[model samples]
Target: MTQVAELPASAAEARDHVHALMATCPRPCGEDALTDALLIISELVTNAERHGGGMTGFRARVTEDHFDVTVEDASPAHPTLPGERPAGSVGGYGWHLVRRLATSVAVTPTARGKSIHVGLRLR
Candidate 1:
């Protein structure tokens, strides 16, 4: 397993990290996985920056069937659905989209903050 450990300054930076990893790593499924992986990374990093008080760490790795992305942030809050608000809300789309696209999602609280792990299956 090859893992890239990088704490990007922004979502763009995080995407660049993953993009570089894709160049060196073999694609288990294809381009679609790349697209999904990028989108997931973007959402995770962006959410951390906007709502979680900025991202603290980032890691991405590819296994035989899984492309996993882990992001750590300053906030300890777990992601929630937008439906908690009114029907028409601007927030929560990122969390919802991430859960919909990711094969697995996890939240772990740390001493400084929390880490969110999201995985996409390459099948």
Candidate 2:
């Protein structure tokens, strides 16, 4: 079974929402995982605001095997996997970091917007 929650637009609010969701997950997800999740969420939200034409909403779902985080925004621009994080780059490392931390990552473009989902395995 999976529990789902919606996050607000504010970064602080989103962070708190994700923390609370992680706390309630069935499996024991570590602090490091939680921190990484939060960072990924922050990056996604920031991208939504800057590139996706503003975030519509975000969903956090905890499944029996994994924890899934999905961010929805107003634009149809699908997120891509970067080859590498260039040195001296101030930004553009969010998706890269998310892919590194999560067991799997996906991006789906819908009629409304695009959903960037990251899955963290529950061991």
Candidate 3:
């Protein structure tokens, strides 16, 4: 399994970790997939810190067909799609982007928080 000894403190660190791992994976994802994966990582981590209390853990791994990332945060609330708002909304698009880019997304609840697992198909 692809693993990290120390959990990353921020989205950049998490993306760096995944980028390095992708280099070693037998089937690396495409450039567009890489960009999408990074954005997914960033949105999830930022959401954890900004809305879900704070991030508690993070992990990224590559399988034969998918690049997977999981972000754990200190909240039980499941993420929701952005509801109707002003015509020119500044934010709340992150979750939607994640859902669109990821091949699959799952949320698991824990005693203290929740973990969001997002997977992107590899080329």
TM-score of each: 0.90, 0.81, 0.88
The reply for model 3, stretches above 4 Å from the true place, is: 84-90
**Residue range 1-123, candidate 2, lDDT tens digits:** 555566585767787787877888777787777888788778888888887988887888776557788888999977544555456655676777777888888888878888888888766
Highest TM-score scorer? 1
Candidate 1, residue 47: the lDDT equals 92
Query: What TM-score would candidate 2 get against the native?
Result: 0.81
lDDT of 1 by residue, 1-123 (tens): 668996888889889888777666664458888899999999999999998988888889877668899999999888778877688767888898999999999999999799999988977
Cα-lDDT of candidate 1: 0.86
Write the candidate numbers in order of decreasing lDDT: 1, 3, 2
User: What are the per-residue Cα lDDT tens digits for candidate 3 across 60-84?
Assistant: 8877667888899999988767685
Decreasing TM-score order of the candidates: 1, 3, 2
Q: Whole-model lDDT for model 2 versus the true structure?
A: 0.77
Better of 1 and 3 by TM-score: 1
Candidates in order have lDDT scores of 0.86, 0.77, 0.84
Clashes counted in candidate 1 amount to 0
